[model samples]
Every structure is written in structure tokens, then in C-alpha cells.
Target: MTLFRESFATQQSLPPWEARGVQSWCFLFPLSATAIQRYLDEYFNFAHPEPAPFRFSALAEAQFGCLTISYYPVIASTNKANMLRYGPQTTSWDHLSYNEMYVAAPVLCNRVTPDNLLVDRQIVWIQPVVMCDNSSVVFATREIVGIDTMHATINLRPGRAPGSLHVDTQFSGFKTFSPTTAEGPLPFLHLETGSPLPGGLPEAATREDKAFLEGLFGVIGGVDLVGGVRPTTTRLISLKQFRDAYDLRLATYQAIVASTATHTDVSDLRFFDPKEVDLDFMWSASAEQILSSFLQLGRPGDEKASAPHEGPGWDLVGRQVKIKVAFAYTNNAVYDQIETLHTFGAE
Candidate 1:
């Protein structure tokens, strides 16, 4: 119940932000347990400030994916502070439109047991890097909830042909591999679904889609049982943190936060052909550095990547094999609500 009034802001912003008619595009890829574990150790280590109360591990079928979501007509939930700050007579800019893209890994979270026996567990996606196109969304998400959100330019739209989609991202990044390169907006990544499978029903979910959804959620909602209800909610985990202002190397606040987005009036769920999906890592030193570890790219003695394939389809460079998609799907939902799961350090 702590509303934030940032020092540079003119008014207080309330939480429980609400959005309607949110669209999401998901492209999943391969990942290994070893690589995921390494990522957790380097960036999201939960073993600090004393061991975490929950046990964390990668899914049996570990996979990494990029979620690009469009949240239109978003509003900061009305409350006393928000009402006073922007009274009814003068309030504008309450509705927002923004796009976000982030890399997430599915993980199994188990409650630590006193008898060394697993008791309760849940599946959640651990988000490491989250980018948004709106500066207001980025600042609010980063400062209030610790989502590690940053500003980027995102272009999300549909192609000329029916059932085709394209999403592109650009971010200000510098080459750590070569420090002399000047920092600028770099082409971070691209996702394009050329077309749906030939003669396939665009309205019907395919077997791959069913299996993928089941793997992620353990049940296929209405598909799993007769007269069953579709699951309306999913959970995501984030490592919320703030660095020490003076030291720059230490965290003044850190915690593990969980957020749930409950979907309603869901429609337009569709699955695309994996081969028809094209994902380009593009040439950004910053993107490569952050995503390569999760995707097992540029590793020594790794030879899976080959020369660029024919045309502008899947290509490989620097051992970053742009494998054909394991699955690609799109859906619409209503997104809201963030809750903290664990706290390690705080002011």
C-alpha cells in the first residue's frame, strides 16, 4: 500500500495498474538446464542474504522465449492519493499505450521442507531482462516494483497479408566486447511470422500449441477435461533490485517478486508454423551478451550453427544458431496485479 511519488515527478502514482485488450506474441526456443543454472548464478542468485525459503530449478524441458506484449489503454488504478494528485477537473494522461519485450525462462519453484521432502510447487517464468517503449512505463515499473525495466523502441504491427505479424526492437547499447564502439540505438532483435501453415485452420489450436501450453501449465485447461474451465491466470517471477547510489557495486534493496495476470474475454488465440517463424538475434553486442548465455550461443567448441540459410529465413552467426521455432503462438488477455513473494534487503 505504498504509493510512490518520485522526486522528479509532479504527482503520486498508484499501483495495481490495469490494462484491457492486451495482445501477446510468444516465440519459444531451446535452452539447457546448465545454461539456465549458470544464468541464475550470475544474475538472479537467490542464495544471498541467507538461503531463500523456496527451492528453484529449471523445467525438465528447459526452454527460453521472448514475450512481446502490447498493453493499450492502461490506467493507474484510482485511489485517494492519485485522485488528490490529479483531480477530476484537470486529470489527463491517465490512459497509456506501451509495448514490452522480455526474455523469460520457465522454472519450477518448490517450498523448502523441514524433512527434506518436496511438499508444494508451482511453475513460473523467471524474467531477467524487461524492456518497454514508454519511458513512463519503464520508470514506474523499475522504481516501484523492481522489474528491471528499461526504455527501448518497439515496433509491433501486422504484415500486409492476413495472419502475419512482425515485431522489432531497438535499444541504446555499447559493445562491451569492443569498448571503443560508441553507444547508440542498436537493432536488438526481430520476430516475424511469415504465414500460418498452409490449409491449416487459423482458429483451431494445433497439437504443438496444445502440448506446449500443457508443458508450461501442466494442464490444458478446457481441453484437458469435459466441461472444464480455462485457466485465466499465470505467474511470473522477477528479481527486483536497486544499486547503492554512492558505491555503484552493491544493492541497497533486493527482493523476489511474483506477478499474476488474469485474463478475461480471451479471444483470437492462434498458432503459427514453426518453420514459417523467423527470429533474428540481430547484431547488438549488448543483446548478444545478455541472451547468448541463455541460448547457448558463442560457446567454445559449439558447432551447431551453419552459414546463413537461403533467403531471409533462419540464419546463424557467432554460433548463435537461429533454430526453427519450437513453437509460436499469439493470444489476447487482460493484464494486471503484482505481488512480492520474498524480500531479502530493503530500506
Candidate 2:
């Protein structure tokens, strides 16, 4: 059974654009209000201009960096009620007052001093803000000429996490695209009692210890070793994962990593179960149709059509298409377990 489902009934349609051919395109252009003001002053020749200033408000200061704009074509629906209800000015999609639509600014700062250095200090700072939000209010301005088409440009910036988990979740959902699977029972490598593996540690004397050791081995073996030695003997396992095997789910993985980094006590950890979600869709057109659509959105007006090398995620659609399809899983839990054969009492 699916863990979650979207309520299509809640969706509202706005308008349709007119164009030619079977393809549609959309664009997202992210820019700060400061940049917009600069563009207006330099290119459009604004009559009045303010002198360059070093200090500005926190909001203004936050807008001085890079931003993100997302764009996607709107597929019109035949339902007239849906269209009129969500049309243009009356549409909730265009209303910026909605909390979910508002962009938030966040600032991160850190300071550190080296242990051995006589006088060494470091400080890190990050400020992210949302600049603008825009969308095309598609209206049936003219009759559909063969196939419908429209071009939209949305101004965006680093904003607060969109309250709607749909977008982020969709991105996360794609991570397991070609997940590794176990086709058969894995071989067991037993360590003789009192015998240590190559690392100088004796074979685990208890089942729990053996399991912990195996989990550590899995993580180390998965990575390439330098000079045939693992980077660190410290095994990094999620607190949630550890809890799943032992029934503790109140702890967090980040805390575990942090504690281990500082040599803090981590005697007890919480755990949870891994949740999985999947999505599948069938399009009428061949794969080429989808590829062409993505390419057009990715590099508008560019003739060269190339698939992005980056793994599937937000980076794939960076500063290009605003509209995208994605899915995600949350509250997933995993556990590290020991490998050992146990015999129950039998006649």
C-alpha cells in the first residue's frame, strides 16, 4: 500500500496558452531585487539612482547573493469550474500572502579555535534570503493554435523551505532509482574464538558485539581504503538505525555524529523503521518526447541536447524548469544487526 497519496481534487487550474507543435516550454529566472534595480538603472536608464552604499538592512544585505528560480509549464484541464475558480487574480497560486509562498531568510554562523595553535581562530558565516516569487497567470488569450504553448519567467531567491514537502520529497524519492539489492544469501566469515582479525582486536565474544563489528566492517569495506588501512576505526552509524535493532527511536543521527566527534557518551540510542515510497507514470510519447521536453526546459534556444551528468536531484534542473515531478520518503528507520546462527531448544 502507498504510504501517502496526493489529493487531485484539491488542485485548481488557471488558464491555457496558445502555440504551435506538440511541445511546451517554461523558464525560471532567479534574481535579487538589488540586481533588478541595477538592471533598471543601467539598461532601462532610471532617472534617479542612489549612490553605492556599504551598509544596508539585514534583509537588503541578505539579498546580495545567489538565488534560485523554478519554472514549469502548466498543463490545462478541461474542467471549466476548476479553471474559473483558480483563474488569474482570483487564483491562490498567484497570491503571495500565503505562508507557504513566502520566502524566508536564514543566517548561519560558526566560530572555532584550534587545540594546539597558540592563537588561531576561524569564523564561518552564511546568509540566505528569498528575493522574489513569480508565476505566469496563463489565460486562454487566444484559441489553441494546433498545440498550446507558453513561456513563463519566475524570479526567485534562496528562500525558506517551501512548506509543501511535495517538491523536496519528490526529489528524495528518486534516490533509490537503481538501489542495490541482495539476490542471494551473503556468505558468512566466522572469526575463531580468541582470534583477532587483521586489526589486532580479538573476535567479538558476544552476539551484540559481533553485530556491531560487522556493521562497522560493511561501512569501511564499502569505501576505498588508503594503503589498505581504513581511515578511522570509529564506526559511524545512525542513532536511529541503532535504535531500530534495539527499540530506541528518540535519538537523532546528527547527534550521534556530533557526540562521536567529541567523544561523548552514546550508551543508548533510539531507532525507527525505514519507510519506502514509489511513483510510476506512463506517457503516450516515446522517451525522446520526454528528453526533448527536458532539454528545451534545461537549455532554452540551445540546439545541443545533452543529458545532465549529475545524479537525479534538484541540481539536474538548476535555474531551468520551474515545474517538475518528484516524490520523497520521510521518517525512515534502519538498524545495524549482528550476524550469527542461533539454535533454539528442540526435541
Task: Write down the lDDT that model 2 would get.
Answer: 0.22
TM-score of each: 0.77, 0.15
Give me the runs in candidate 1 sitting further than 4 Å from their true place.
1-13, 43-45, 61-66, 69-80, 89-93, 114-117, 176-179, 197-231, 299-337, 345-347
lDDT for each candidate structure: 0.60, 0.22
Best by TM-score: 1
lDDT of 2 by residue, 1-347 (tens): 75322235344232221111111111111224443333223322211122211111212222222111223222233334443444554433422110101111111111222332223221111112111122222212111111111222122222222321111211102211244632221110000011112333345556754554454444334532321212222211111111234547521111111001111121211111111111111111121232233222222233332222223322322222221111111111111121111111111
Candidate 2 regions exceeding 4 Å error are: 1-37, 43-45, 48-60, 69-347
Q: Provide the lDDT at 264 for model 2.
A: 19
